[model samples]
Target: MSTSDAVTTQSPALSSEDRSARIAVTVFPLLILAAFAIAMITPDTFKPLAPGVNWALGVIMFGMGLTLTLPDFGLIVKRPLPVLVGVVAQYLIMPLVGWALCYVFGLPDAVAVGVILVGCAPGGTASNVISYLAKADVALSVTMTSISTLLAPLMTPLLTAWLVGNRMPVDGAAMDILLMVLAPVLGGFIVRFVAGKFVEKILPLLPWISVFGICYVLLVVVSGSVNKILTSGALIIAVVICHNLLGYLFG
Candidate 1:
């Protein structure tokens, strides 16, 4: 093969992995929707798993971390401007948009609080998986998530107080988040370093695992509030969907 052909062509195995990742992304939302249905239909079944949601999130983060290398961190340092912009958007843009949605939608006090809280929250761990599936910069996503999470303890309460007149709790959340988010990620990073080749072979499997893990997490989360979900009016749902979509579009 000529030099250009060598540069342009992909190995069959790599092509397969790309296909699998694409399929995972395509089906991810459907699986999550089904999880919601199951939760709504049989909320009690998933209730017992409620306590493990944080740990489940941790496992998903671990899978994401295994895909990383020391070079990923180096990339973050090398390109600090984009990382700062992403972090700023995660905190400033999303939260303000959420608060605006609440006011425009005329959400009830309790529901408005929920919306604002979610907005004020850190970058969700799931974004890293989605970014990987999209073949985007997972390292940047991880770095952004880590920074947002670290800022959340302070920013969440401050934003809530400014927007909702009530301070969200700031105590002990950092330690728990470190365990569920940062610690598992570091452990996976180290494990990948120790078993680099084996981990590379399994990288394609991670997306599939993430699909089911995310479904289970969604199911467990929705099950915990089935009654509330059922009672929530269409307006609340519309506001939430708007907030989510707008956050993505603007961010």
Candidate 2:
């Protein structure tokens, strides 16, 4: 066949890799919304599971790890400056922005703390996909995410303690956060390493798994907040929207 003919025959739509990554990017938030809806509709069946929510987050982190390779780290080692800049930008920008917003808007303590928590969170795995879509530096985005997440066990608590200390009791236990977040991520990485070819074959399904995990977390949070939400629905929605928008803008 002519080269022109072959070129013409190629599909212009998204490749499998693109489609899977999109799903991975979207699943978590969608699940969160779905879970919240379920909780709102049937609170009895949707009792909050705080620990389970944590575990689901861990699973999502692990799924992220499974997609990584040693070279991803190499990017950091080779070009330390950009990665450092990204990490610093990530750590400083979000939390401070959140803090400023809370102060300026006169958010209550609990709501303020919630905003801080979301801001203090590291760059999510979804950011890599977003960066790709925006034609930004994917490597930098992934590196920032990986390093920030690895640092979460330390940074999250420290930032939380520093920002929300007056508002709430901050547990400055890096080890606990590490065990809660990194353990699952490392475990998933090891599993992927061991199952190499098998993992490659089933990689397409990771997005679905991540989506389910996120939904579970949202459900747990929403279920826990049902009474408060019912009583202060407008306030709760406002806080959530502001928190999310700020994270995206400053993240």
Q: Which candidate is the best by TM-score?
A: 1
lDDT of all predictions: 0.85, 0.71
Per-residue lDDT value at 114 in model 1: 87
Q: TM-score of predicted model 1?
A: 0.91
TM-score to native of every candidate shown: 0.91, 0.74
lDDT of 1: 0.85
Top lDDT model? 1
Candidate 1 has its poorest 10 consecutive residues by lDDT at: 10-19
State the TM-score for model 2: 0.74
Provide the lowest-lDDT 10-residue window in model 2.
166-175
Residue-wise lDDT of candidate 1 within 72-164, one digit each (tens)?
899889989999999899888878998999889888898889899888888877888789888789889988888888887888889888989
lDDT of 2 by residue, 153-204 (tens): 7788789889998533445544455565557656766887788787778767
RMSD over all Cα atoms, model 1: 2.9
